[model samples]
Target: MRTRRRFLIAALAAGTAFALAGCETLNTVTGLLGNQLNFTQPQLQRYLNHSFPREFDKLGGLVSATLTNPRLSIPSGDNRLRLDFDIGVSALGARDVSRGHFALASRLRYNPATQGLHLDNPEILAVDVPGAGSLLSGGTRELVNTVLVEYARNEPVYRIDSDVLNRLPSGKRIGATDIEDGRVVVRLQ
Candidate 1:
C-alpha cells in the first residue's frame, strides 16, 4: 500500500513539473489546439526578425536610419523581449555617415480591447554614434524615441486579425507574459 502511495505522489509531482516548465513548448501546443499562437522561441524569433525590418521600412519610421545585425534575445528573469540592432545614420544633412545601435526592452502583455500584444515601456536602451561624440549633445536616445513614436503612431508592432479580436471578451485579457527556458508564454483568459 505504501509503495502504491509513493508511486501516485511521484506521478503527480512529475505532471506538475511539466505543466510549470519555463519554456513555451507545452503552452504553444495547447495554444495551437485552442486556436491561439504556437509561440515557440524559434518561431517567434524567425517571424519577428523577418517582419520587423519590413515594417520599419514601410513606415519610413526612422528617417535615414538603416538597420543591420538585428538580434533578439529572451533575457532571464524579465518578461520582455530584448531587441538589439545596429543602425546607420546620415549625419550632417547626409554629408557624413555614422553608426549607432539601439535596444528595446519591454514587457509583453495582451490587451483584450485590441486582442493584441502590447510592448509596454519600449525605449532605446543605447545609442553610440561614431566620430560624432558631442554632436547630438547626449540626445541620441531622445532621437531614437522620436522615431519609434512615429512608427507606432502609424502602425502597431503586432496585431491579431479583427475576426479573432472580435471573439475575445473585451474585459478579459492576458495577465502576464514571460520567455524562459526557451519559450514565449503569454497568459490568456
Candidate 2:
C-alpha cells in the first residue's frame, strides 16, 4: 500500500511536468512582445506573420476606408477618428475565415493640403480572428499581401482618445466601433 501511494505521487508529478512542457510550445514568442504599440521590427514582423494570412486571403489591393467623426471626447484629445473597412479574399481555404470587422484607432497627423489624417505607424487597433485553424492556405505571402493592401488603403483617418485606447504599443482591440464601411477587392495574379 505504501509503495502504491508513492508511485501514484510520482506519476502525478511526471504528468504535471509533461503538461507544462506541452504548454510551453503554445507560448508563442509573440506573447512576450505583448500588445504594446511601437514594436520592434522583429516584433512587428511576427505580428504580421501571424495576423495577415490568418485574416485576409489575397496579398495586394486597396482596401476602402471610411472615417467617422467623434461625437464625444476623452481626456486624450478631440481630433479623434474612427475607421471601418474590409479586405477581400480570393480563397478563404478549407478553414473558416472570419468576416472582416475590425477597427483601428490612430493618432492622426492632419495634412492640411491633402485634407486627410495620416497614420503615423502600423499599430493594430483591433482584430477579429474568429477561431483556431482559420487560415488562408494558398500561400503565406499571398494571404499576407491581401491583408496588407487592405490595411494600406483603409488607413485610419482620425486621432484616437488615448485614455480609452489601450496604451500598449501593440495592443489589438477586439470589439467593434462606429465608423463608415469600406471594402477591399482582391485580384488574382
Candidate 3:
C-alpha cells in the first residue's frame, strides 16, 4: 500500500512538470516568431484610405446602416484622423431612408499579435442632415461606434503585410505609434 501511494504521487508530479514545460515551450515559440515593425504615413494612407469605402460599408451593415463614400484624412498637427462618410440610418422596422454627411474623429491604436492598426475612441465630430436638424445629430454617435462596430473587437482596423504581421507576434509586442504630418509611424517588438 505504501509503495502504491508513492508511485501515484510521483506520477502526479511528473504530469505537472510536463504541463509546465509545454507552456514554456509555447512561450519560446512565440518569442521566436515576434519582431519589431514600422509603418509610414503614406503606407498607411494608401491602404487605409483606399479601403475605407468597403470596410466602412461592412461596419455600417452591422447595425443595419448604410455607409458610403468613406474618405479618410489625418488632420495636420492632430494625433487623430477623420473618417468622413455618407450614412443612411434605418430604424423602426420600417427602415426610414435617412441620409446625411458625417465625420468621425478617432485615435489610433495597434495590436502586435495581428500587426494591425485600430482606431480607438471614435466620436462623431460633425454631422449634416437636411430637415432632421439636431434631433439625430448627437444621439447615434456613441451608438454607431460602440454597437455597430463589431469588427473592432477582434479585427484590426488595418493589417500590415502578412510577412510583417507574422514577425511581430504578441511575444515581442508593439512598442509605439506616432501620427505626424500626415504620416503614421509605428514601432513594434
lDDT value, residue 116 of candidate 1: 53
> Per-residue lDDT tens digits of candidate 3, residues 1-189?
999999999999999999976664344344344443334444555565556443232233533455667677778998887777776654434335567777887766786676678777677787664433333443556445643355455556567656544555556555666666665556554
**Cα-based RMSD of candidate 3:** 15.4
RMSD of each: 10.1, 18.2, 15.4
Question: Model 2 scores what on Cα lDDT?
Answer: 0.35
Across 1-189, the per-residue lDDT of candidate 2 in tens digits comes to: 999999999999999999875553223223324532121222222323333322332334222112222121121332333343343233323433334444544433333343323443334455443431134444333343344455445533332224423332344442222112121111111
lDDT tens digits by residue: candidate 1, 36-79: 44355455555456555522231243235566666777776666
Separately for all candidates shown, the number of backbone clashes (residues 3 or more apart, or on different chains) is 1, 15, 3
**Candidate 2 stretches greater than 4 Å from native:** 1-57, 60-97, 131-133, 137-189
Candidate 2 C-alpha error for residue 90, in Å: 5.2
For lDDT, candidate 1 versus 2, the one ahead is: 1
Q: TM-score of predicted model 3? A: 0.58
